[model samples]
Target: MGIVELKNLTKSYKQNRGIMDVSFSIEEAEIFGFIGPNGAGKSTTIRTLLNFIYPTSGSATIFGKDIIQHSKEIRQNVGYLPSEVHYYDDMKVVDLLKYSARFHGNLNSTRMKDLAARLDLDINRKIEDLSFGNRKKVGIVQALLHEPKLIILDEPTSGLDPLIQNHFFELLAEERDKGATIFFSSHILSEVQKMCDRVAIIKEGKLVAVETIEHLTKNKVKNITITFEQPEQFTFTVDGILKREVNGKEVTLLYSGEIKALLQHLIDLPVQDVLIEEPTLEEIFMHYYE
Candidate 1:
């Protein structure tokens, strides 16, 4: 069985809107990416999985246990970091982290110290006095302190600088290497491409697609740039061409099918130079959005 599973999960708030029939699964030690634009039900699905809100219909499970019925038990092995974090202002960072670890009935003093040092977080500082990025660091450290089996991160890099984000991602990679399953939700397509092994895309409160990163990208879009011997009225009829651009004696376009056919057609044209490469995740994302 999968470590995480959802069967036709639906959550409706009002006016027939909210996530509908959302379903997916995460295998043990897999880093699954959940991606969509704002208001696309990414958060809603995640909340349901965490049992912060019950689904209107269907069901989900984590570690082979029902998410809602065995929430406490599931939570004991799960660590979550929300997009935004709030903490008791009066407490010191170290004290709050200790409390979080104790709440899980597992505290590793060495791990806590290591995380703080790696994140460059000052544990002695009061929660109210830290910067947004620093507070995010605290949240990261707290969530991973107990070394839970599952990690759920919702836009976990929001307040972090690029350097800290790199450090945080490295930490997550280490965790994954140690047999932890990760559920990474983010709208940043590049980050998803960089970190996730597979991705599930949602749009307008419904799932659009879910596939391995390789399968999702392989031969899906090809970016071709060509320079002609002379300026010509560049027009070609082909299937699966999504975009085209023209410049003086140069043409660039995105194609998604039949490389052999495209090459056959190009052989007869005034193509002086050519460059072919895979499209970026953002380009592929636009293809799906369209």
Candidate 2:
């Protein structure tokens, strides 16, 4: 069994909304990405795994223990950062973090201070006084304070700046290096592309695909742009060319299949420059949905 395993998991709500028959496994010490837009049952799946909400059917296990039966114990070694963060307005950040740490017998001030400094967070500030971004920082510190075995993050980079997001990713890498499994859920493709080894795509409460980053991007589709020195029109009659757009002197298209053959076809053209890139996750989504 993997570090986290879900078998035929289903969670149904009114109006026939929620995930259905979703099954996947996350390996130990690996970063697994869950991707979908809001209201796509990403959070529902997560909440069900953590036992915040019960699954309608099927079973999930964490660390070889059933999620429902061993929820309290399972959570002792798991850290979670939800998409939306809420905390007591009356308490200071430091106080709240300490309170949370006590649950895991980890009210270690030094670790908390170190994480706060690394994230440039002021723990002494009152929760109500902190901005949305700063509040998110507090959430980060709280989630990592105990150094849990599994880290589950939902849209963690929402309120963070680029630099801080970089730092956050680095921090996650460090945790992963220390043998922690990471279940990173995000709608943003770039973040998943940068961090996850494998990605699972979900849409409208159903899973569509689960694949390695290279398999999904490198093997599935590539974006190619050919430019000429002067205005020239070109036609590409390739079977796997899913999309083609022509602008004066430039032809851009989304292509799949053998790169060697595509290059062979382009070799005879008057190409001044060529740019080939892997399509983004959004493009991959469209590819799957369509």
Q: Give the alpha carbon lDDT tens digit for every residue of 1-290 in model 2.
A: 79999999999988857899999999999999999888888999999999999999999999999999999999999999998899999999989998999899868899899999989999899999999999999988998999999999989999999999999999999999999999989989889998999999988888999999989887879999989888776756867888788899898888887778888988887889999997887787777767
Model 2 compared with the native: what TM-score? 0.90
101-163 per-residue lDDT for model 1 (tens digits): 888987899999999999899999999999889989998998899999999998899889999
How many clashing residue pairs, candidate 1? 0
- TM-score between model 1 and native: 0.95
| Residue pairs clashing, model 2 | none
RMSD of 2: 2.4
Off by over 4 Å in 2: 227-237, 263-275
